[model samples]
Target: MTPLLELRGLGVRYKGAVAPALEGVDLDLAAGERLAIIGESGSGKSTLARAVAELLPQTVIQQGTVAWPGLDQKARNGRDIGFVFQDPASSLDPVMPVGDQVAEVAHANLDMDWRAARRLAVELLDRVRLPEPALLAQAYPHQLSGGQKQRVAIAAAIVARPRLLIADEATSALDTIVQAEIMALISALVAEDGMALLFVSHDIALAANLADRVAVFRHGRLVEQAATAELVSQPRTDYSRALLAAHLGLHA
Candidate 1:
């Protein structure tokens, strides 16, 4: 089977930056596979995620090929990829009704008519388990809880049933309980959609919970990657060990 997403010889350097944010990175994820990219701040995890989603700004210099099954770079420009950012509040439009925002995605990418897209929007809200989907649809972003907003974000992302979900620090802003709930919800949604997931986070334990495999990045370079259990139990590099150690201490 063809890979759901592939990156090769990928490198990124922001204008006037001292070093590349990412350098010569390669990753391939198949359909329904869950992969996590974990590293400390400034480790290029977010850059990698944005690059994969093709959401990077033009100011950054980029070198690489992003390959998706049966689609060239031009053809892969739409709904086949969905990106959920760290903060839904920032990503969402405060002025627009959240429902309309969600529906707009379907309208824009899926070519659904307004009425049909709006109808599907409420269904998506219900799918994400949001309360009173109809009422919530009419509400503004500020009216919803952080978790609810994220769910709306998720709902919007999957409204078109994209093949790959790029979650860039998606659950980082939520409270502990809400964070776990969002993670579980996203995991379930990904599985249900058979969408490959590339989850970017600093939380090793959370990644271990949701990912089949994990990739470790350090200073714009991919240092290690393996099955989650193997990487957690037998980290090869000192940095990987340190990351896992801190994660363990957090739970202990």
Candidate 2:
């Protein structure tokens, strides 16, 4: 079967930056498959995700193709591709009720009226395991904890039932316990909905735990990619080895 997502010679450079954030990278994610882009800061993993989602800023110069051979039409950002950014505070509207924020996506993408969209929004908040979905629906971004806000963000992302979910460092900002919770939530949702997942993170161990495959990146280039087990057990490149060693050290 055709891959749900394909990238060919993907490159991105901020207009005034000295170097490109991403360069000549190629990757793929199959339907219902979870692929993690592993890289430290400035390594371009986030750039790759944004490129695929076409979420990059207007000033950036992007090259090459992000094609969906598995779908007939080009993907739209909020409709077909759901993105959970690292910071939910910035992604969500502070003034709007969390439910309304989520409902807006469903209302816009699913073409539902506000009342119906709001009902679906509460249902989604419940699905994300938020406590007292009805009450939380009225809460604003500032009212909820970091994890709760992120949960609201997740609810918004999946409200349209998108074909793909790109989680760009979705758990990085949270505490360790909350990180695990969010990871579990993401894993369960992906499995339950069968949406292709593009998980971008610096945490090799987390990537190994959640991804079918992990693609290592460095300095805006793809260093290597392999099955999660294979990559963790026998990394091919020195960089990959170092990354694994670092993760081991952190947990040890």
Measured against the true structure, the TM-scores of the candidates, in listed sequence, are: 0.96, 0.97
- Model 1 steric clash pairs: none
Question: On residues 55-96, what C-alpha lDDT tens digit does candidate 2 reach at each position?
Answer: 789989998899999899999988889999999999998899
lDDT of 1 by residue, 1-252 (tens): 777777899999999999999999998888889999999999999999888877889999999887776455442433888889999999999999999999999999989999999999999999999999989999999999999999999999898788788899999999999999999999999988888899999999999999999999999999999999999888899999889889876221
Which ranges in model 2 have alpha carbons more than 4 Å from their true place? 250-252
Global CA lDDT of candidate 2, please?
0.93
User: Ten-residue segment with the worst summed lDDT in candidate 2?
Assistant: 243-252
- Tell me how many clashing residue pairs each candidate has: 0, 0
Worst 10 residues of 1 by lDDT: 69-78
lDDT of each: 0.90, 0.93
Output the TM-score of candidate 1: 0.96
Clashing pairs in 2: none
Error of 2 at 94 (Å): 1.0
Model 2: how far is 63 from its true place, Å?
1.3
Clashes of 2: 0
